[model samples]
Target: MSMADLVRAGAPELPEGYFYRVRSTNIRSLKVEIREQRRFRSRLVADTWVFERPDESAEESIVKACDRAFKGWQEADAVRASYLAVTAYLGDHDPKGGR
Candidate 1:
C-alpha cells in the first residue's frame, strides 16, 4: 500500500500535531517514523520491520511494525515511557483548531 494510505488508516487515532510516515523502504523492509511536536520541543522515533512478501501483506507489515515499536517503547522503562506519555498526551488533545 502507499504511504498516504497507511497513514490515513493507521493514524486517525494519533494526535493532530503528531504524525507518522514511511521514512524509508526497500525490497525487504519498510521503515516507519512517528513524530511529535510540542510547544518547546519535538521528538521523533522510527521502527523498521522486515517482512516476507509471500507471508504478509502491506497492512500486516505495518501493524506488526507498529506493535513492535510500541512494545519496545513500553519495555525500555523510564526515558521511553516519558516520551510515550508525552506523545500519548499530544494524541489525546485536540489541535489548535478544532477537530
Candidate 2:
C-alpha cells in the first residue's frame, strides 16, 4: 500500500471542515475550512508540514510531520531527540532510498 493510503487509514476522523493532503515528498498540506472553533475563531486556517530539507516532497513531508507530531506529543521534554528519531526513521524507511 502507498504511504498516502497508510496515512489516511491511520488518521483520526477530523471534523467537517478539516482536510489533509500528502503531496510529493515533503509537503504535507493541511486545510481547515471551518468557520470557527472555540479559541480559533477564524474563518479558515491553512497549515503546512515542512521538513528540514527543502528538496523533500509531499510524502516525505507527511512522514516527517507525523513523526514529529507523534514524538513531540509523546515526549514533550525530549523534542530534539524525538525530532532526530523521526528523521532517522524516515531516512531508513524512505521507499526511494534517497533517490
Candidate 3:
C-alpha cells in the first residue's frame, strides 16, 4: 500500500523530521525502520522488533515502530539536555536542527 494509505490505516503519526521505512526481509518477514532526519541524512532512531521474530502484522509493526521512535526522541532530548547546554555554551546553538 502507498504511504498515505498506510498512514490512513491506523499508522502512527510522524512528527516533523521523522519518518519510517517498511521493508520485507523475506516472504515471511517484514521490517520497519524509524528514523530522524538530520542535515545531510537521516539516522536510525529506533525500531519495533529489532532482532526478534516478526509476529505482529505489518501495519501494527509500523505503528509500534513510530511510537518507539517518537519516545526515543523525547528520551534523547531529556538525556542529552546537559550535553546540549554545554555545546550551546560553547557557541553551537543549533544541533540536530532542534528536532
Clashing pairs in 1: 15-91
Whole-model lDDT, model 3: 0.67
TM-score of each: 0.48, 0.30, 0.50
* Deviation (Å) of 33 in candidate 1: 2.0
Q: Per-residue lDDT tens digits of candidate 3, residues 41-67?
A: 988876544233277765665666556
lDDT of 1 by residue, 1-99 (tens): 544565465632345676555545656457755567778976875454635466787676776666566555446656777788888656455567655
| Residue 41, candidate 1: C-alpha displacement in angstroms | 8.7
* lDDT of model 3 at position 47: 58
* Best-matching candidate per TM-score: 3
For every candidate structure, what is the RMSD over all alpha carbons to the true structure, in angstroms? 12.9, 17.7, 9.1
- Please rank every candidate by TM-score, starting with the best: 3, 1, 2
Give the number of colliding residue pairs in candidate 1: 1
Poorest lDDT segment (10 consecutive residues) of candidate 3: 45-54
- How much RMSD separates candidate 2 from the native structure? 17.7
**Judged by lDDT relative to the true structure, which candidate is superior, 1 or 2?**
1
Error of 3 at 95 (Å): 32
